[model samples]
Target: MPHHPAPEETLPVIALNGPTASGKSTLAVDVALHLAAHGQPAEIVNADSMLVYRGMDIGTAKPTQAERRGVRHHLVDVLDVTEVATVADFQDRARTAIADCRRRGVVPVLVGGSALYQRAILDVFEFPGTDAAVRARWEARLADEGPEALHAELARRSPAAGAEILPGNGRRLVRALEVIDLTGSHAATLPAWTYAIPGVRAWGLELPRDVMDARIAERVDAMWEAGFVDEVRRLEAAGLRRGRTAAVAIGYAQVLRFLAGEITQDEARADTVRRTKRFARRQLGWFRRDDRIAWLAAGDPGAAATIAHDALGPDALTTDAPQQRCGGGEQAHGQRR
Candidate 1:
């Protein structure tokens, strides 16, 4: 049987995904502008979890208003630091934004680094059911012995799922265990690639490992210079430590440790860089598992235009940028955006 598309599902969405410092955000905006200039208006719908929180700008490397070049963006700064958001929650919000854009005859651009979160939004996925008793039991263990303990158990139950989730994410760990308990298996493991919505095209940015390492180091250095510590301090005043998810974010956690006097500022910076590098590797591995993404080598001068053209068609751009930005490469794009 032929699959007939729904009205909203027929609209196009451009997904620029990749590891940190691979420039997904910048590419997303550039694509939006290119699409608009070429007669297909587009808007950016942020797919990064951290970017959703207000007052997390510096550490998250969120694009400033000027950096966005006046492109309308959805899901940025939608939550306070004290609030928590689940994958299901984000999936709902992102789809709503995409639908709104389509309803108005505009293309929706999906941008972010977290592979799992991106999959939640774009893939045909249904989160496993949760049992209150099972959840409470795991939550109790989480509170008693800490997240790492449960993470170990999760690894035993589902190695791929465990590897995808961070050890410090107690809430996520508990949820995974609960889902496992209810269904007798964890569905967080990467499933066969399939998009929930039709006509969603994804592109990934690929950089040489050495270059990626240098970029991450430079980004961390810039963040500290840009007052990353100060940003965390400000959020701390606003109850950042109280938020389970935000409190443990890569750079935020290190800064929080420094703030608590558990480490020197230098130590925090070093730890942030090291941890971010490790995280970038994980992000790369996760995205690589999704064969649907077309990976582009980094710094292909005309790749952005090529992707814009792919989304908007031959009448897509006025510029003479080359049509091939990424082809015959490895992995999906963007790290923990």
Candidate 2:
């Protein structure tokens, strides 16, 4: 690591963003290696909210030690399943991590499937203040009348927020209702684009819709084969059911229902795939609104090279690196959908 950062006011943050099953982990590793080998040291900082929880490895598709390829990753597996992962908290920690890496003169590679999290970090996004009483009231109503009832109220209050949040998402509905009640309006589910720092570039990778859908299904199938049910079973034993955020995670939620005899295994698998694909589409839609992103087709040859050059510039790899830093070549080239 460098003893001091370069004399820039702000370092550029390279972002690898895509939907579920987009293979962002593999692509990010490849990009990091390419940067390191060329004299620009870089490290990955996870932006996915789900990736924060430990014991969520298989379902979240977290990279194993082998897949990390010796690169240091920040903000991955830093939270227990019982701890809540909120955007405000994540924003502070992620900003600190990015600043730390920049202080060491290492590029911060932001990668995740959560579009909201990404926008919160890179853009001038501030969360609405929450009131305990307001939240409690909405949560109680959600428990009594169900999520759809509150969702209807949200729709009546703020049509935009209502259209964005899913009706089945009781947690989000409660939050939205609370925000509307206290603030007189609810912001859109995803933040509007307004980057906080200059030169922060997001690269969007996507496949054809059909291929992406198939991959989501296949990934969910692989998770079950890899004992996802067993993993969730262990977590439930460890009190995952009591965890607000972890309990509602994509595969974990569905599988937990299956384990409780609320649904069949096949239903769990199908719902997992369906919800994941829906999430992917939403991610793509959210990213599409950001005109600064340089969209790239997934599996494109030399795409990693493109991101590396765009991030570090042509002189970074060719010219001698600035005084400081430890550092790679490309490995696997997978991307998120």
Question: Per-residue lDDT of 1-337 in model 2, one digit per residue for the tens?
Answer: 6566362335668888987877788989998998888788889999998889999999999999999999989999899999888888899999888888888888889999877888888889978899999889987898799878888888888888877777777878888888777777776445667777555767878789998999999998899899899999999998998887888888898999899999999999999998888888977887877766667777765667777866765455333332111111111111211
Compose the digit string of candidate 1's lDDT tens values, residues 49-156: 999999999999999999999999999999998998788889999999999999888999999998988898999877776678888999899989998999999999
**What stretches of model 1 exceed 4 Å from their correct place?**
1-9, 315-319, 324-337
**Model 2 stretches astray by more than 4 angstroms:** 1-10, 188-192, 316-337
Error of 1 at 281 (Å): 1.0
How far off is model 1, as Cα RMSD?
A: 4.0
Best by TM-score, which number? Answer: 1
Q: After superposition, how far is residue 90 of candidate 1 from its true place, in Å?
A: 0.2
- Candidate 1's C-alpha lDDT? 0.84
Would you estimate the TM-scores of all the predictions? 0.91, 0.90
